[model samples]
Target: MAYLNKLRLFIRKPFSGLCDFNRATTAQCRKPLPIWLRRDIPPAGKIKRVKGILAELNLQTVCVSARCPNLPECFSKGTATFMIMGDSCTRACKFCAIKKGKPAPLRADEPQAVAQAAQRLGLSHVVITSVTRDDLPLGGAEHFAKTIRAVQNQLPHATIEVLTPDFQGNLDAIKTVIQAKPDVFNHNVETVPRLYPSVRPGANYARSLAVLSYTKDFAEKAGKRIIIKSGLMLGLGERRKEVLSVMRDLRSVGCDVLTIGQYLAPSPNHHPIVNFVEPEEFEQYHQEGLKMGFLAVASGPIGVKLRQHCHCYGQTAP
Candidate 1:
C-alpha cells in the first residue's frame, strides 16, 4: 500500500527522479517552503560584483550547479565558494547536478585565477571545492593542493577550506592535500553504507571514512592541527539509525564539525528528494549530534557548508 502511494507521488512529480529508490525507506512528504521563506532570505550585498568576478575568472560555483538554497545569503555577504578541477565530473551520483562528461586538460592558470578572485571579492575566508575528477591520475589532488597554496599566498589572512575529493582513497593523494594545509580540510561522506550503490554509485562509504581518519592522523603526525569537517544530506531515504551510523563513523575519525541539511534534487534527472525535511527534525538531529561529540554542529532547513554558519572547529584538522 505504501509502495502504491509512493508510486503515485512519483507519477505526479515525475521530475522527482526517485524511481531508482525503494519507497519504504523514504520519509513522508512535509509541507513545501512558504513564499515568505523565499522572500526572507538574507541578501547578497552586490550581485553585480559576484557575477562579474565569476565571469572574470571563468569559474563555476557549486552554489550555481547544485542549486544551493544558501547562495543568495552567502553571496550577499561577499563570500563565494569556488569549484575547481573543471565543471565536468567523473562520478554520476543521483543527488548532484554538476555535469558529467569527459574532462578537459587542466588549465595551468586556474589556481592563480581562483586566488585572485578570492582577493577581488575581499573574502576573509574562502571555501574551495571541485567535482570528482577520476580521469586524472592523482584524482586532481595536486591541483587541489596548488589552489590552496596559491590562495594562501595571495591572502595570508584568508581562512581557506578545501572540500576535496577522496582521490579514490589514495593515501598519497590525501597526504598531498594535507601537506598543503588548508585551515579546514573537508570531505563529505555523502551517505550511509547501504545507500552507496543507489545514491553515491561511484563513491565508497568506507573509503571516505578512512580518508577523514587518515587526514587527521597525518596532520597529527606533522603536528599541524587541521579541523576535519563532513556533511550529509537528509531526505534521501535514510533511516534515523543510518544517519546515526554515519555520525559515528565521522566521530571515529574525530571530525570536528558536521553539517546536516535537507537534500533538494537539482532537476528532473537528478535523485528525487524522499521528503522535505522539517526544521524541527533538523533541530532534533543537531541536538543529538552534540551528544555524539561534534564540536560545532549546523543542522537546520537552511544549513550549508560554505556560509558563515558552516565554519567548523576541531582538534588536529586546525
Candidate 2:
C-alpha cells in the first residue's frame, strides 16, 4: 500500500506556477524555507569575476551543475569546486539537477585547464569532483589522478580534495585515486539506504560504502594519512534513527569526516522534499556524529559547503 501511494505521487502532475521544473520553483510539498536556510545574495562584482574565470577556462563546477543554493556565496568568495569529467552525468539520480545523457568525450586538456583556473582563482584549497562517468573504463579514475597531479604541479602549497564516484566498487579504480594522494577523498552516499532506489536508482548503497571502506584500508596500507569523507542529504523522508544509523555505518568504515545538509528539491520534477529539517535537528545530528567518532562533522543548511566547512575541525596531514 505504501508503495502504491509513492507510485501515485510520482504520476501526479505538480500544481500551478509553483510546479515548473526548468525555471525557479517553490517547494510544492513542504512549507517555505525557514529563516536559517535563507542566505544573503552574493556581491555581483565578485560573482562576475569568478564566472569570467570559469568561462575562460571552460570549466564546470558542481556549484552550477547541481544548482547549489550556495553557488553565489562560494563563487563570490573566490572558491569553486571544479567538476572535471564533464557537465553531463551518466546516472539520472532523481534529486540531481545535472543533465543526464551521453557525456561529451573526455577533454584531454581538462587537467591543465582546471589547473589554470585554480591558478587564476588563486585558490589555496582546491576541491575537484566529477559527474559519474560510468561509460569510461576504470570509471575515469585515471583522469582523476591526472587532474590531481596537474593541480599539485600548479599549486604546490595548496590542499587538494576530491569528491569522487564509487567506480562500481572496483578496488583497483579506488586504489588509483588513493595513490594520487589527495588530502581528502570523498564520496557521498547521498541519502539513507531505504531511499536509494527512489532517490538514487542508478547507485547502490552497499557499493558506495564498500568504496569508502576500501579507500580507507588502501590508504592506510600505503602509509598515507588521507581523510575519508562522505555526505548525506536530509529532508528526504528519512527518520532520525535512520540518519544516525547511516552515521554509524560511515564511522564503522573509518570515515573521518561527515556532512549533513537539507535536501532542497532542485525542480518540481525532482524528488519532493518530505520535510524541512530544522536548524536544531541539524545541530543535534552534528553533536551525535562527534560522539559517534567522526573527526569532524559539518551539518546544517550550508553543511557541505565543501571548501569552507570541511577544513574546519578536521585534522589534515601536512
Candidate 3:
C-alpha cells in the first residue's frame, strides 16, 4: 500500500527504481493443493506467565495477530516475537491475516511493556515484530528502535530479533533502528519474486532485499556482525529454482539465518495453498542451505525446521 501510494505520489522515488508497478499483476499460476491441510499444532510445554505478562504489558504479537501455527510451541517455551505498535496493519497483503486499514497510533507504553514481558518471561531471546506502519512518519522505525532499546534496558543480556518492514527505502530511518544495536535484524521476504504482487501485494522483492542488505551492511560497518535473518513461505506456487535463487540472493546480501516454512493459508479469503512442503523436502533444503554455508537454516512442514535454530543462534546474542 505504501509502495503504491508513494509510487503515485512521487513521480521519482527511491524505491521506484526497485519495482515496476505496471508489471506487478501478471502472475496467475494455479495448482491443486492438498485438502486436509489445516491442522492445530500443539506445543510441548507451557509458558508459565505468558498471557499474564502480555495482559499486564498490553503488547501484541504476530504470533496472535497472524495466527502463527507455531504459537503454542514458541510461547510454551517462554519465548515470543513481540509485535510492537499494534494489531492493525497499514497494508492488506492477500496472504496475510492481520487486519487491514488505517492503523491506530503507537501505544506509548508498548516499548516498556515489551521489555517487561521479556524480563518476566526470562526470555534470553526476544523477537519483536510489527505490522507495516506505512501511516507513520519514519514508517515507525523509531518505534522499533525504542522497543529494542527498552528490551535491552530491561534484560541487558537478552538477544533481540526484530522482524521489520522495509522503511519505505529511507536509509536514514533504517539507520536509526540499526544504531539501536539489535542482536539480529530480520525482515521476512515472504514469497517468491513472481507472486509478490498477488501474494504480498503491498511489498517488493528488491525492496525487501535492500532492507536486508542495508541491515547487514550497516551491522558489519558498525564493527559488530549482528546476525541478519529472513524467512520464506513455501507452497505458494514457488518453484524449487526460485527458492534456491532466493537463498542465493540472501547469501549474496550476507544473511546468516534463514527459515523456509510450508505456507498454510489462514482462510479461503487469503491465497489458497498450492501445495504442502513435506518434512523430507524441507530437510533437503535445510541441508542444501547448510552446504551453501548458511550459519543457520530452518526448513520444514509447519515451519518446524528453524524453530530451534533461532533460539540457539539468538541465545548467543551479546
Candidate 4:
C-alpha cells in the first residue's frame, strides 16, 4: 500500500539532509525553475551587510532557518523575519525545513539582541517568529513577550508583528503574548483540516483556529487594536473548495489579513509538492480573500510571504 511505498522511499534515499530542497528532488533538480516562481538573482553586497549584522548580533531569521526562496531579495532590502527561541523545533512537522529535534537552551539575551538587530537594520516594521519549542512550560510565550517589549523599548515607533506557535492552544499562553500588544498577532493554520495529520502532525486544526479566535477576542476586551492574521500553503493536493472553506473559517474568527503561497518541499524526505498553483488561480484567491473581508491579501507564487502587505495593515504593497 501507500505506507509500504513510502517506507521503500525512506530506505532508499534515507534523507541524509544533504539534498537541495529549493529544487523539487534530486531527480528533478535540473528542471528549470517555474516561470511563475522565478526571480532575479539579488546583489550580494547588501545581502552580506545584513547577514554580517545578524551574525554580530547573534540573531537568527526565519529567512535563513526555513530556507525561504525570498531570502536573497529580502536580505538585499535589509529586512528579515527574525527567528527566536532557538533554531531547533520540538515538533516534527513534515512540511517544514527547520531541523526537528531537541532545541538548545533559550538564550536569555536574545530578546535584546533582536531589538538591537532591528534598530541596526533601521526597520520601520519588524516581524518575529520562532521554532516550536514544545518542551518549554509555556511554549516560549514569555520569551515572545519579552522580545516584543525589548523591540518596543528600542524602537518605539516601529510596528511589531509576531507569527507565533499555538502553545498547545493554552489560553494563558495566548493571553501572555496578547498582553504584550504586538501590532499584529499571527499563527498560521498552514493547511486544511484534512491535510493536518500528514502536513502538520503535531498541530491541531481546531486548536489553531481557536488561537486566532481567542487572540482577537482577548485583544478586543483588552482594548488593543491588534490585528489577527493567518496563512496557508497551497499545492499540497488541496482542493479549491477546501482552501475557500479555510478562508471562511478565518473570516468567521475575524482574521484581518491573509497570505496564500505555494508549498515548496524542502527535501526528498519532506512531503512532495503535489502541483504548482497557477498565477491566475493565485489572483482568484487574492480577490476572493478581499471579498471575504481580509483587510489585506498577498497571494502569489513568489514573495507572497515577504510582501509588505502581509506585514502590516493599510500599507500599500510594494
Candidate 5:
C-alpha cells in the first residue's frame, strides 16, 4: 500500500510556478532542473582563453573537477577556484561530483603554478579549494599553506580565501593552514546533522563545528584577525528548523560569513534532490542569516551570484 501511494504521487504532474511535491510527477518529484540554474551563453573566445591559461599552468580547478554549474559563467570571467593537490578526492561524499579514488601524487610545483595563474588573471581576490586528501599525514594542510604563500608572493595585494576540508578534526592541521593567514577561512558544513549519515557519511557535524570554533580561538590567541566562513545546502531532505539550527551553531562558533544554496544532484546515481526550494524561501534565509549576526549572507537559486557576493562581501568586484 505504501508503494502504491508513492507510485501515485510519482505519476502526477507538478503544479506550475512552485515546486509542489504533492502533485509532482517522478521527474518533478526529482526536482526538475530550474531555470535559475541555467546560464547565458558566454563568448566562446573568453572561455577558450581561460581554458588555455589553466592548461598552460597545468592547474586543476574545483569548477572543472566538481562539475560546478557555474563553470561557463566563471570561466567566461576568467575566475576559478584553484583546486590544488589534485583533481581526485579521498572521501566519497554522496552529494559531490569530484572523482573518488586513490589520488595521484601531489605535484611539487603546484603552488607556483597556481600563483602564476592568479597573476595572469590579475585577480584581486583569489579563492582556493581542494579535494579531501585523507591519505596525507596532515590532510594536505602543508600543501594548502604553500599554495597560500605562493599566491601571496605573486600578488601581495590580493586577499586570499580558502575553502577547505575538516582535516578529520585534526586541530594541528587546521592551525597549519590558519598560520598561513588566509583573509577568509571557509569550511562548509554541507548539510544538517540529521542528513550527515546519508549525505556526508565521511564527515561529522559536531567535529565540523568544533573546527570552526577552534579556528576562531586560535586566530585570536595568535593576535591575527581572520574572518571565519561556513556554508550549507538546502533541498537535501533537511527541515527548515534544522537549517536555522545549523545557522545558530555556526554563529555560536563566531562564524562571520555564510552561504546557502539549493542542492542539485550531480548525477542520477548520486543523492537525489528532495525538493526544489523556492526563491522567496532563499531570500527569507538570507535575511534570517543577517539577523543571526552574520557579517555577510548569500542565499538563492542563482548560486554563482550568491557565491560571488559572499566572496566579495558586497565590495567592489575584483
Candidate 6:
C-alpha cells in the first residue's frame, strides 16, 4: 500500500523532481527514531477516563489537537493543557498539527468548562493555551483572561500558567492577560528568526520577541513577579549559533524559563525534519542555559513540552 502511494505521488510529479522527492522520503523513512524518542503507551483505561471527562465537558486540549506524543502519558496522570478559543487556529504555521481555518464564534461558556474540568481532575498546576484568533479585535486576550479567572475561582490554590500567542504585538492585549496575574506566562518563539518566513509565516520574529519583552516589563511594573517563559524547537534546519542567538534574545527579555526540544514533523506535508538532534546536544544546551542564568531549562528529545516543565523555574527560583 505504501509503495502504491509512492508510485502515485511519482506519477503526479515531473519525472526529474519525482526521483529526488522519492529518494528524500525513502531516506527519511529508513532512518529509525532515536532511542530517547521511543515510548511505551500508557494504560488505555486511564487515558480513556481522561478523554471521557473532556468529552463530557466539550473541552479541547492541545494534547489531542496537536497530536502530542506525550498525550497518553500525560492523560494517564490526569492532566492536560486546555486549548481555549476553540480548536481551529487562524494562523497556518507549517509545522503545527492543529487544524487551521475559519474558527467558530468564541464560546462564553468555555472558561467555566475549563475551570470545571481542572477542578474535577484536581489539578494543582493548570496550563491554559489557545488557538490564534486573529479575527478578534483583541486577539482573544479577554477570553484568556476570563479563563484564568474562572480557573482561579474554582481552584484558588492551583497555580495558573498561560501559553499565549503574540496577539500581533498588541501591548494592550498582552497587558490584559498579564493583569490577570497568572503565576507563569509562556509564549513560544517556536523557531529561529531565519526560519520564520518558511516555518512560521504568519508570525514575525521581532514581534514575538517584543511580545515577550513587553509581557515581562508590564508584569514587573505591576509589582507582579510573574515568570516569563518561551520555547524553541530544534531540528528545523536551524544552526547551533542561531539557536544560541535565540536564547540570548530570550534572556535579554528576562525570560525566566526556556524549553528546547527536537521538532517532529506532524506529517510529510509539514516542514520536513532536517535533523534528529542528539540527547548530548540537548544536554549541552541545558547546561549552557543554566550557565547563561536561565532560572530553569528543559531540553531533551521527549517529554519536553512546555506544560511538562511549567513548574521547573519555580523549583529553581528563590
lDDT of each: 0.72, 0.77, 0.70, 0.78, 0.77, 0.78
* Whole-model alpha-carbon lDDT for candidate 6: 0.78
Off by over 4 Å in 3: 1-48, 303-318
Cα RMSD of all models vs. native, in order, equals 11.1, 10.7, 10.7, 10.8, 11.6, 12.6
Clashes of each: 9, 0, 1, 0, 0, 0
Q: List the residue pairs that clash in candidate 2.
A: none
What would the per-residue lDDT of candidate 5 be over residues 1-318, giving only the tens digit for each residue?
442332222112110101101111223224566766555667877778888999999999877776666666667777778889888898999888788998999999999999999999877778888899999988999999999999999999777888889999999999999999887788999899999999899999999999999999999899777878788888889999999999999999999877787777767777888888888898888789877887667677643343333322233222
Model 3 Cα lDDT, one tens digit per residue, 33-152: 333334454554464467667877777867667765556556776666688878988888877778987788888888988888789888766778788888898899999999999988
lDDT of 1: 0.72
Q: Positional deviation of 13 in candidate 3, in angstroms?
A: 40
On the 0 to 100 scale, the lDDT of residue 111 in model 5 is: 96
lDDT of 1 by residue, 1-318 (tens): 442332222222111111111111111223355332244556445766797899888987777666665565556666677988888999888877678899888889999999999999987767888888989978999999999999999999766778888899999999998899887788888777888899888889888999999998999899767778888877878898989889988998889767777676666566766776677777777777777877656675552322222212332211
Residue-by-residue lDDT tens digits, candidate 6, 192-293: 999999989999999999999998888878887787878888888999999999999999999977778777766677888888899889888987887787
- In lDDT terms, how accurate is model 3? 0.70
RMSD of 6: 12.6
Off by over 4 Å in 6: 1-31, 304-318
Name the better of 3 and 4 by TM-score. 4
What is the lDDT for 279 in model 5?
Answer: 83
Candidate 5 regions exceeding 4 Å error are 1-30, 304-318
Error of 6 at 297 (Å): 0.4
